[model samples]
Target: MENSKEQVIQLNLNLIVARGPPVPTIPVPVVAAPPTITVPAFRSEKFSVPEQFDGTRSKLLEFTTQLRMKLEVNHDRFRNDAAKVIYSVSHLEESALDQVVPLVNANLAAPFSSITAFVANLEALFGDPDPRGTALHQLVTLKQGKVDFATYYSQFLRIVANLDYNEKAKIDALTEGLSEDLKDAMTYRTDRPDTVEAYATMLMTIDN
Candidate 1:
């Protein structure tokens, strides 16, 4: 019996030796590096400024939109707003610069809040807020005497685009501008269009 008890004790000792000690694990935290951003360069030299400030507002806005898309920056902080404005208007006449330079110099200093704010400031100083005056005059004065329907249609649409005219006014302007023979023939049609778009479609059919 004593030999058997010593043998059991020996077995327990061997098991403990085989198992070894418990290890305490410590987790190390992982750190991520800041993101890097690169903006695409614009060839500002390729663009020329408009002859006058009358239609330059839209042109500049379009330019800024293209530039902002290319840069892919959320805010104007990457390129100084003032610098961007100057670059945009650099190709304009000296008279245009005379107006824009001082205003930009005075107003566009420091951290820009957003691209919208920057563009708004420049737009306000560049041209008339409403362009309906010139656009309406052009639409009213246009006539399709010798020009083809497609050419006349393109010019008609361009002028009417800037006007704040309703559907009725648009349809009327379109009908009135057609050649005398085409206008007469369209007026006699039983399916004379009620919508400006439908009228435009009919005109396109004539063009085709």
Candidate 2:
């Protein structure tokens, strides 16, 4: 029985020796890096608030322009119509502030359904009554006498654009503003331009 026991122990020792020591595991790292997160463009920069508005017709246009630019750039900052309206109202003074008092107090019951409605009201209250008429009067007197063709063209275009004149009217006004030398050159061209853009190009070529 002792011999049988010794034989069993030796057999177990042999089985243990057959198997080698266990290997430890080490994890391999990933080759590619994680994606980078990007922040919003507007959040990176600072913007100034628009200047206060005092209900002056001449300054109204400038005020609205500044306010529009400010709101458009950081749209996330002004998410809704009420937010935009409140921001604009904050910059008002005297008469302008007085005008929006009822709307501000009304809150949810304000007449302004949209920011556009609010701006239109402001324009009606303090904007040029006869803007087109004013531009037309200026256009009739504008002459390209001493200035270069390019300069005169830029000035003429700015005034005429405000009037929304037809193609024929644009050509007529363009021709009328030409210097004496250009007017003389126009008479010689057999293949004249029909469109306003083509006409402007023809005049530029002649001027050059």
Q: Work out the TM-score per prediction.
A: 0.52, 0.59
Q: Write the per-residue lDDT of candidate 1 for residues 1-208, one digit (tens) a residue.
A: 9999999999999999879786768889988887877788553433333232333654664555565553344233335665554444554455546765665666655323445664565566764566778787788799988888888888887788788778899888888888887876776678867888888888778656
- What lDDT, from 0 to 1, does candidate 1 have? 0.66
Poorest stretch of ten by lDDT in candidate 1: 45-54
lDDT per residue (tens digit) for residues 60-171 in model 2: 8778878888887766776687777777788999898889888788784444776678778899999879989978898989999988888998888867867878898899
Per-residue lDDT value at 17 in model 2: 78
Q: Cα lDDT of model 2 overall?
A: 0.83
Deviating ranges (above 4 Å) for candidate 2: 1-54, 58-70, 90-98, 105-111, 162-164, 201-208
Q: After superposition on all CA atoms, how large is the RMSD of candidate 2?
A: 6.0
- The Cα local distance difference test for each model comes to 0.66, 0.83
Give me candidate 2's TM-score against the actual structure: 0.59
In model 1, the clashing pairs are none
